[model samples]
Target: MWLTSKIKQLLMVMKPGVVTLNYPAERPPVPKNLRGQPVWDHQKCIGCGGCSDHCPSRCILTRDVCQELRVMLYDGSRCTYCGRCADICPEGAITMSNSFEIACDDKDDITTRLELFMMTCQRCGRCYEMEKSNAIDRINLKGFRYDNLEQRALVRTTSETFSPELLKESDNYKRPSDKE
Candidate 1:
């Protein structure tokens, strides 16, 4: 009986079928919804730090070097691919790609960088933010939309300019007399 079972198993194995992938030599097909790794579209990114803020593994880092510049850093080794960063991005900047073979000997090999130019407020002259940000969009401000240009430009004039009284009520607001 054992011999018969062995012969039947051997016959089944002889049939042509896929056993394993010939990886490295041949690339495997990636599924549509596979969340392998995160890829950043710098053109679409607004540097709002939304991805860094939503990253659960703390793999994303955001740094404001000054009012005019912002930097985004991503580390693959620390990432868990939770997809929170991609979801929270208002600009659709971060997207998951099918490139999961991220092994590397050096830790720095897994790092990704993005740089963004910040827009200084023309009204207050102190506040700085992404060229196209939620704050500008929230008030339904016209002429500040990212419609005409592929890259949104910083509006020298904003709704804040119309409401000086509102700015005065804020904590960051400073009177000219206070400067003395």
Candidate 2:
């Protein structure tokens, strides 16, 4: 009776034999709706910081180097792959790619850095419309952001214009201690 039961189990296992594929040599096709990794289109991106604001994991960072220059960094290591950045982006600049294998030794291998040069209006000290129909008007922040890229910290402060004082303050931002 034991031998018959063992034989029956072996027959069931043999019915679906050799289902595993040689991963490195023969890769499986990525699904159509896979939300793997986020890809950015710099041309379409206006450095609005919408993606940074919407990221649940806060992996996205934005730093305003100057009135004309803004630096955007996307750290894939801390990202939750929620696709919120892609969805919140007004310019459709962020897109989720099908490449899911992101294992790497160095953090820079998966990091994405973008330097966006903004054209500001001389009168208002605000970003000018890139196009007649461009949605630059929909940007949430009125002026500049001073996020710390070195510390990987997001500074929620903004200035209506280029303020060196605000930049200095952001540079000195300290994390709250548990003792406090």
Candidate 3:
């Protein structure tokens, strides 16, 4: 029985080398659903903060509130690749790429930072305003921020008091001044 078990074990361990991967020589093909590392998709991302909100590890950080917040900061050491952030992203912006070779000697060197453009909601079919764009541009230019006003260019108080639902969602809604 001992001889038979040993033979079976050897056969199982060396069965024609069905595995294709050879370490230090070649790498195996990445599976489609394999969540290796987090990467931001600039165009597809809506900058909704969903991924940041859902991230269990809190490795992802963004400065832009909407359109400009598309920039992302990632700390590879802090990220456990839990896949929660990717799953919660509504726009499919966050995804896991097959980039596992992320060994780094310095901790700070492993941190990655990026900028992203914010998506906007429009009223008259015109691109409205972005919160962090002007501010970031100025900061990238100037030395300091003055009362965060530099970042306040994107704020809109909406002087028009009209209900947005009437203009946008309701097909039958006509301006109150207009009637049959």
Give the per-residue lDDT of model 2 (tens digit) for 2-49.
999999999999999998889989898889989999999999998878
Number of the predicted model whose TM-score against the real structure is largest: 2
| CA lDDT of every candidate | 0.59, 0.82, 0.51
Ranking by lDDT: 2, 1, 3
User: In model 2, how large is the Cα lDDT of residue 130?
Assistant: 37
Taking all chains together, each candidate's TM-score versus the true structure is: 0.57, 0.79, 0.49
The clash numbers for all candidates, in the given order, read 0, 0, 8
Residue 43 displacement (Å), model 2: 0.7
lDDT of 3 at 131: 47
C-alpha positional error of residue 39 in candidate 1 after TM-score superposition, expressed in Å: 1.0
Cα lDDT tens digits for candidate 3, 104-161: 8996676655565543345522122224344422212111111112121111122122
Error of 3 at 27 (Å): 2.2
Please list all clashing residue pairs in model 2, or write none if there are none: none
The collision pairs in model 1 are none
